[model samples]
Target: MIIARILILLPLVSANKPQFPLGIAVYANPEFDICHRDMRAVMETRDLKFFNSVIDKTRIYSWPLKNFKSDIESLHNSPLFQLVRKMPKGAALHIHHKAMVNTDWLYLQTYRTNLYVCDKHNHLSLKFFKTPSNDCNWQALYERRRNPLVRQVLEDRIRRQMTMLTEIPDRSDTNVLWEKFQNIFTFLRSFLNYRPLAEDHFYQGLLELYEDNVMYVEVRSGLQKLYDLDGKIYTTTETVNILHDVVTRFKADHPDFIGAKIIYAKSRDMDHDELRSFLHETVELKKMFPGFIAGADLVGHEDAGYKLKDHSSLLLEVSNWTDFFFHAGETQNFLLQPTNLQIAIRHNAKRIGHAYSITKEPDTLRELKEKNIPVEVCPISNQVLGLVSNLRNHQAAILFALDIPVVISNDDPGLWGAKGLSDDFYMTLMSILPMNANLYSLKKIARNSIIYSTLSENEKAAALDSYEKRWQQFLINVTMPFCDYTQVMYSWLTLDRNTW
Candidate 1:
């Protein structure tokens, strides 16, 4: 009787054991398991090739274990990156409007007619001038680029100034790095904000994402007034309408494209009255273009900006009018009083941007998990901005381990010459996530992007349906030619389609 009882308990315990560890991978189906095994083999083969080719053989082989700008070329050449580029990312929830297009493309716009450049206080500014002005010693860009030698030198200088790439990425101070980062946007604003160029820029930005297999995007736009070379200015309302028209035109051309939305953003350093005025304007815009305007956010360097708690009353008052997707906890200082994460949660933000320091606050992490608020993880942006030296040490890895919701995003991809979500996804997979992470991990993160979006319930359902079809096709395309027929059939037989 004792032997029989022990045998009975043994099977029960064995049956209760989990097939995989807790976290996003736990959701993997048998079909994904088969595909994952194949992907891993390819990854290992490609990685070994990369390791052998490194000039210093003594250096360890770790893809994306270095600075993003430094490794971008190699990443572009990577087979894994090609695979990720083809993967259907549901939505990009944390991109900024100003830096959406590649800098190289924006630089080409400088060659257009009627554009002028000015040098004042050792700062460069571009503007559309009807006639030349002596204010700040303005010169026509057309004339400057007339000589081939001068144009080549000018292009090189402008390209370097427009990007944060450097041979030595470790800046003496984080503040210095941020100054350079902001300065890039300030210089590019003139090119991007021009009326005709702005329209094309927005369209091309959408096309860039579409080509990379991303179906939807929510842009954090300041809605800065648009200007023309002809000297006419567009109001904020008109700017909103122009963006909507752009989306309409884009969707008409690409029917499968889900569309784009704007998160009206303002500098977090605004005084109370200034913030209030922006908030009221945001509310009116949302009312005017409910579908196009997803919500609002306060964007700037978190360390130097006003705390969310300082203007909590005003933020809370407008919560009903528009969703809040505040940028909180992007700093290294996790111990600051009234942490931005805490205040953002208290104010009911639809999603938290970055949350880089959340690992230090277990209580806040638990609250975010419990509340089901997904944090937009911009791994490259964090590394580029001096937040983390290596992608492996990023906090999103910890969050993913605990099964917290995370949506990978390219915060300002264009600034770094990264075109779409692929590079960020590649960095997350190669370094930030566990070695065992595979297609299922990508699937879960992709699903979270759509599920956590500000899209309507009906829209979410349609997007998911579309994502499923695309996902099925992707799996078949990537696995069928390489996978064993019998094994593929067996995995397909056991797959629970509803679970995904």
Candidate 2:
């Protein structure tokens, strides 16, 4: 009896050791494993250790931002942060177009002559007029900036109203933050509507993303007309054409960039008739600018807006070729199942943006896996918007474990004072992912962004090739200091995807 018991205990003890860790198995594809090996080798170098030490020291000085913990702010000055800025971010698929540039740029642009700010019932609206209007009590921004005493005060007020950097009110109240967030966007409309400012906005924003190593992007816009300094508005077609012109000019200067596309977004609050008209308009625009316009989305606060099922008839009216990128499951309502997520899945949405509440329904989770729907997980955006309290608890890791492809994005980086996807990438790796999440997972995430993007097959191949070359160069630069000369056999080129 004692011998039999010992034999059973021995088998149980051996069974406790997993045959393969989940992360490793999930990322065991040959192409990915090879690339990850090269990336991992560089990340483990002594140079990276020193970089991490600098980050560790700066954690104490980080600001207590409402979006992320103080420690995440600490990475702003670290060398690893610099390295991440160089890492191939693949693509930005879910960012808003107007929120792409910094607010300071808007403030400076409004200082030009003829611009006026009107305050009505504690709400501010900026407009351009030949002269001040007595009926609306319009204040000229140029005059405010000219006075030394008012200059600092005016700048402070503008920064606080346009961005979330200054004091945030009522952290516990998501409603308050949501209202404040909507107000900021409203205030920005006055400045962003100007044609010249809109042109400058696109140029500077794309340049910033290019500098931060993002090759492609799909910016969502409401397709609103841009107004001239005299308040004369351009047509929606003209507005999109203007964006294309700016993109063309930028590409002329930077040929290595894969390119950018647009996804027309309409608020979910619109009634059935309004949504039907908007859908027709979007379809017309897509025909006119087939290469530039990629898809459409229903955008707004999910909890308070109309559910996706409410527009099932209208959504089904869209052509099968047209992509539907739905923004669903962004609420924290545990009592309610994610019916919006289910609707998106049923409609065959090309991708889902911020499916934060998917964990509440297990059946939907299984469907997401079986259908292979990719999710655009914006961590900092989720935290800042009050959908999530901490990045560590974000549920993005759950998606990864379930074989749901995910891509990290900075939904509104400019509003939160982030340069590009670099900060979001760092936050996801350090705070959101599990401790066992390795370089392989990072590579897979990057590749997923490219493969799942709207880029054509030829463009995808070119982008991946470009990304691989830059990644190799980055590894060589960081690891050359401590690399052993004898261990050069597994160099980036020498290790093919077919090899181990």
Candidate 3:
């Protein structure tokens, strides 16, 4: 009788024990549970097939590996990767506006009449006008690319100058890689910082994101001004207007697509005065285009730049109205003490970008848990930028295990030859996400993106409703090959919810 009582109580004890922290439920209605499970079943079966074929045979040259080189090598041609491309990713919340598109396109843009290039200190720079002085060392790119061999070399140089292709950046010298990374932007500025090209580039970037099945995106633009070829400068207001127009046009063409927003990011290396000026100007811009500028962020190498604490006063000046999208804990140097992350939490950041070291500090981790701040996890960016070596051991899995909400993003995807968010999503599922993380985890991640976005309440409701319809369609499409009439009818009934 005592043994029977113990067995009965054992079930109760296990029930109270914490299961995996699944974060917030995607839906309040329990009827959606059946829909989620069926969707999960299809995705899990597909995942198993992918693993059994590709992961089990990594010795084969065509498998997708963790690092940038191996992954990029197989990414373009893989059938499984194509499936990832088709999957409906809800939102991409952490892309840099400038680095949204690849450099190859920028190289082609330089050919748009009379563009001069100079080779200074072995670094390529571009200018719109020709300089008569030989001392200027400016040569026309069009003239230089006339010869076949020279053209090949010139294009190759341009590609290398704008991408992180050669080096494998690790913790020992991330600064070196960062220097190269920043220089790429400087090199491409003349080509991309012009008005017409800027509009085209931004639109093309959105096209790529849309093609990858990403419905919504929030890009981090530094609110820099654009210039024309005739040295005519466009103000920040004009730039913002151009961005708005581009997104509006894209949405018009793709009616089913949700909208995009901008997070006006600024360099942390700026002095106090510059920070104050930026805030003032951004506030004015926000007044002009209320919905266009969603929030503000500090964008730079987290290790070398000033921590958020240094600019607290200036930051607090606009904290009441302007939401903070702090890029904190993106470094390995401060493992023992994550000052950046701690300051971000203190400031009550809406969302933390690349909180790579948050897991180290227990107090900060707990605070983040209680506050429910989502970490924008850029797994490929971390690997390529030298923050983490292997995705298999990335701290994101630990954060996820602890119920910390994470949204996978493609940071600087273009620089690394990643076409869209699909690359990051594929990498997350195959490498970073734990073995037990299933389609429901993916569903939650997608849901968290909208839940944490700067969109208004009504917009959120509309977006979620639209997403549900798309998800239902996606389920039918993905499971079509594996399902027969009975399974199809069951899925339809589950989606109909009223039947229950």
Task: Give the alpha carbon lDDT tens digit for every residue of 239-336 in model 2.
Answer: 99999999999999999887899999988999989999888888888899988998889988876757888998888898564788899888886455
300-394: candidate 1 lDDT, tens digit per residue: 99878568888889988898888899999999987677899999988788899999998888899999988988899999999888899877789
Candidate 1 residues lying further than 4 Å off, grouped into runs, are 1-20, 26-60, 147-150, 482-496
RMSD of 1: 7.6
In terms of lDDT, the best-performing candidate is 1
lDDT of each: 0.79, 0.72, 0.74
Better of 2 and 3 by lDDT: 3
RMSD of each: 7.6, 8.3, 7.5
Residue runs of model 2 more than 4 Å from their true location after superposition: 1-41, 44-66, 69-73, 131-135, 334-338, 482-500
TM-score of 2: 0.86
Model 1 TM-score, 2 decimals? 0.89
Rank all candidate structures by their TM-score, best first, as comma-separated numbers: 1, 3, 2
**Candidate 1 or 2, higher lDDT?**
1
Between candidates 1 and 3, the one scoring higher on lDDT is 1
